[model samples]
Target chain A: SQQGEEDPQALSIQEGENATMNCSYKTSINNLQWYRQNSGRGLVHLILIRSNEREKHSGRLRVTLDTSKKSSSLLITASRAADTASYFCATDRRNTGGFKTIFGAGTRLFVKA
Target chain B: DVKVTQSSRYLVKRTGEKVFLECVQDMDHENMFWYRQDPGLGLRLIYFSYDVKMKEKGDIPEGYSVSREKKERFSLILESASTNQTSMYLCASSFQTGVSTEAFFGQGTRLTVV
Candidate 1:
């Protein structure tokens, strides 16, 4: 079963706009991470925010986590055509004796030029 | 830099044929994973290996099996390929650094079954 579910299955915005993507999960997690995929290729890790931290920033990317609500959001400050891709949120949780990471279906963002 | 390499970037096979997908990570990570990505289904875990000669089933493990004879290599095998099994296969590895350490992925293999 999938642990995280991303909101706004798809989003479209003009260049230079800010894009926000939300993810909600069902269970507790040690951390939440976001990734980007171009077309159908492999994933690129963006940011990882631990449960102890509520917010983190890397360059123009800002991520916020609300463990109480089991939700997280990713904010792209300045969008560009190059930013167009599929974004996914993943939750890392303890399972059995090890850890398992579950990824959300993802949000397709299109930054029009 | 850690590198996870998949044997093939694209593959084609006939239905009912045996298929093998190989992955190797040079970072000496303890955990390795195999995931299949589809159009709307996102990435689904097929199998995971925490150590050499150990493996575990993921959510969708019906048509796939895995082998981890060495710590740096993980192989995903399809006993008999089917049309539905064709998808983008990704390999990843992560160290047991702490809570929620990052995972690095390979270039991915796109398999097409006809």
Candidate 2:
């Protein structure tokens, strides 16, 4: 079973607009990570936030984790046409041996130019 | 930079034929994983290894078997390839055993079983 489920299965916006995607998980996690994938390509690591941290940022990307709610959100500011891709949230729960990151269904974002 | 490389970008196999998908990481990371991605199912874990000669079953491991004879390499095997087994296979590598470990991925291999 998937440990996380991403919201807004799909989203579309014009370039320069902000894109926000949310993910909810079922179990307690030690940290959460966000990833981006271009069409038919490998996934690129975007950012990771520990359970103790509330927010993290990298370039135009911002991520927030709310352990109380077992949820997290990723925001991409000033979206570009090149930013079109699928975003996924992976959970690394405590007690898992190693590299046991469970991924969500993912949110497909389309940035129109 | 960490690099995870897959043996092929695409593959084609016949039903009932044994198939092998190979992955190698340059960083000597102790952890490696194999996942299959489908349309709505997202990415489902098939198998993973924490060290040389070690393997563990993931969420969906019924049709897959894995080998890790070398620390830098992991191999996923399909005992008998079936059409339903065709999908995008992904390989990843990570450094440690904690939640904060970041995984590096390969470009993926699209397999087609006929």
Candidate 3:
């Protein structure tokens, strides 16, 4: 089963605009991480936010987590054509004796140049 | 730098044939994973191993099996290849540094089962 689900299956905006993607999960998670994938390529880790953290930022990326609502959002400021890619949010949950990371469906973001 | 390398970048196999997709990580990470990416289904975990000779089934384990004889290597096997099994296969490795560490992924192998 997919533990996390991202809203807005697809999004398109101008190069200078900021893009926001939201992810909602069902169960409690120890941490949430966002990843980026270009077309026909593997995923790359972007940023991670622990459950105890409410927000985090790295470069142009900003992530916010709300445990009470089981949701997380990724905001990309000053989007560029190079930022055109698919974004996914993953939840790291403790299972059995180890941790299992599950990813969401993902949001396809297209930054028009 | 952490490097996870998949055996092949592109593969073509016939139906009913046994297929093996190999993955190797140079970081000596304890955890390795195999995931399949589809058009709309994102990346779905197929199998993962936390230690040598230890394997666990992921959400979509049907039609797929895995082998981890060495700590730095993980192999995903398809008993009998089918057209539906053709997709992008990704290999990743991560160390349990703290609560949950980030994973490093390979370029991915695009497999086509005819």
Worst lDDT 10-window in candidate 3 chain A:
A92-101
lDDT of 3 by residue, A3-73 (tens): 89998999999999999999999999888999999998888999989999999999999999999999999
Candidate 1, residue A108: Cα displacement in angstroms equals 0.6
CAPRI docking class of candidate 3: medium
User: Alpha-carbon error at B66 in model 3, in Å?
Assistant: 0.8
DockQ of each: 0.68, 0.74, 0.69
Candidate 2's DockQ is 0.74
Off by over 4 Å in 2: A94-96
- Residues A1-113 of candidate 1 have per-residue lDDT tens digits of 89899989999999999999999999888889999999967898999999889999999999999999999999998899999999999997675537877788999999999
Which candidate achieves the best DockQ against the true structure? 2
Better of 2 and 3 by DockQ: 2
Per-residue lDDT for B14 in model 2? 99
Q: Candidate order by DockQ, highest to lowest?
A: 2, 3, 1
lDDT of 3 by residue, B10-114 (tens): 999999999999999999898888999998898899998888998888999999999999999999999999999999999998986556679889999999999
